[model samples]
Target: MQTKTRRSMIIIAIANGLLLFGYGLSLPFFTIYLISQRGLTSSMAGLVIALAGLSRCVSSGISGELADVFGRKTVMVWGLFSQIVAMFALGLCIELKVQVGWMLACYFLTTFLGAFFRPASNAWVTDNTTPKERVEAFGIIRIGLNIGWALGPAAGGFLVRYSYSMAFFFTALLYAVTILYLNRQVQDNHTPCKSRKPSFVSALLSLKDSRLAKICFYVVVITAVNSQLVVGLSIHCKQYLHMPEYYIGWFFTINGLVVVFLQYWATRLMAKIRLSTAMFIGCALYAVGFGSVGFFDGFTLIALGVFLAGLGELIVSPGEQTLVSNIASRETRGRYLGMLMVFYNLGSAAGFFGAGLLSDYVAPHYLPGPWLIVGAAALLAGWGFWRMRRSLTDEEDGKTNVPVPIKKDTITLN
Candidate 1:
């Protein structure tokens, strides 16, 4: 039984990994492609990315609620099917020589569809696993995520060098493969919630509960800091440091290799540390890593900074996700994860736009502006973690001193 379960998890991880890899392959290059091929300004490219993230903020929440009303598998299937269409649309955009505005519209639609999969995927794992198993399960998923991210860009860069259309074609093929893998290999029989659909506004309102609100806030801040890697770091490397385009893939590859080797061990180590402390330490590392960018010009030093940032990311991401999972009730798992994902998307969108504006006008020095912002964001997140550390500890101990569960229906505070 354990073997079968493990096999199922691995299959799901591969499907998820492929989907993410396809996205990562395109993400770093999308803006550059738009600027070169479509005559878009840097600000316009940033806006396009921000719009996709904005769509995710809306779509993830709705998908989370829908996953609760329908089954997780049902929602996941919908997401994957939509991804196929999105990839095809993207490819078509390239073929038709679509305008930049139209391309941005497609990108928004694609991301909106894609966002639905994440909450469903997260909730499905929680639905399947026991508490003791969840941390390790999440770690496995994270490994798959990193592996996909690591491979995607390197593959995409090589494909783009041959033909930009080939990049989209490859992405579409991966999406098709992902759909087939999920359809053939996976089985999810969890029942959907029978309750009436919850309003997104009401869900957002529920976050007013001090403890839950605080946790969400910290997640937002941390995600904002992390966004600099995707939006700012690549641009910084290319513009100021005169790094070659191909090296962007190598940077992520190095980070992915580190995470693949270290994440399992890190997950085990996290068993000994408080989740909040781990998050705090992770944010601090981000601060140091991003801050160090201002002082370093060598590719080696910059790569080292990225490696340290990845290390911090490895520590915080799984721990923070596990912490969120532990805090919510089973019935509301989708909604909680969805809400968390929204915060993540919002932070990322804000960071991208903010970084773009700063790099364009405020600090033509490009590298320093985004790095400083990321550092400041990390410090702010750390402070939020410290303030809530006591509450996190109390809640873990089953102490009543912590705030009550925001919803009356929640079974345990965790």
Candidate 2:
């Protein structure tokens, strides 16, 4: 059973990797494509991207509810199916010279469908793994995610030079492959809750648990800080620092390399450290890295800062995820993860919108605004983690320290 579960995880990771790779390939070029090829303004492009995230925010909660009522596997398969359609629609939109507004609509649909899959995927992992293994499992998944992210953009950039349509076509092909892979390899793990259906109202009511609520809040803040990489740092590089376009891919590559090589060791090290303490350290490093951005003149120095930020990301992310999984009820695990993702999407949208507005109005001073906000947000989150550290230690000692079969058969939802 353990071997089968592990094999399933590997296959899921690969499928997820391909899907993310397709998305990553398009991400760096999407705005550029809008601006250069489509002759749209930067704000318009930002709006389109923001709409995608907004769709995720709205759909995630719904997806979680669906996962609980139906089955995680069913929701996941459906989500992947939607992604395949979305990728194809995106390609068709570009190939047919669709209007920018229509193209944005296609992007929105894609993200909305894609958002439904995450909670199901997360809950599937939680269902299959014991508490001790959850962090490591998530870390392994992150490796696949980052690896795809690392390679996708560079490939996208090369492909874009030939034809913009190729980028979307590539995304479509990869997602189609992902759908087939997932359909064949992944198994359904979703058992219905005691109730026949789980509603959004019930999910909202579950937030009465202060610890759980706080974790979700922190997840939002952390995700907001992450937006620094996509929106904040992008502006900083392009506007303030006047860096070349190719370096954007290089920055992601550096981030992926760090995660690929160091994530396992980092997770092990974090096991020795308190999860809250690890989060605090991660946030501090993130702050320092973002804060130093204004001061760095060379690509090497900036890369160093980006790498340091990635290190901080590595430390906090898995630990935070583990902490959430440890505290959440088994029956509502998908809902919990989905709630966290809602916060994540909210944070991401706000960061991009806020940064876009700040950069637009603030002019030359705009570059620092987003980073400073992110740095401040990280510090605030770190402080919140520090306050919660004692509770975490007590909980870890009492509940999470125990070891069990990697695939614990306790179905809390049932």
- Give all candidates' CA lDDT scores: 0.74, 0.74
| Lowest lDDT 10-residue stretch of candidate 1 | 395-404
What TM-score would each prediction reach against the true structure?
0.91, 0.90
Over 128-175, each residue of candidate 2 has an lDDT whose tens digit, in order, gives 887767777888777777788778876776777777777887887887
Q: Candidate 2 — which pairs collide?
A: 331-413
> How many clashes (backbone N, Cα, C below 3 Å) per candidate?
0, 1
Expressed as tens digits, the lDDT of each residue in 128-157 for candidate 1 is: 765555666777888888888788877776
**CA RMSD (A), model 2:** 3.4
**Which residue pairs does candidate 1 place in steric collision?**
none
Deviation from native of the Cα of residue 14 in model 2, angstroms? 1.8
| Segments of candidate 1 deviating more than 4 angstroms | 1-8, 365-367, 393-414
Residue 174, model 2: Cα distance from true site in angstroms: 0.8
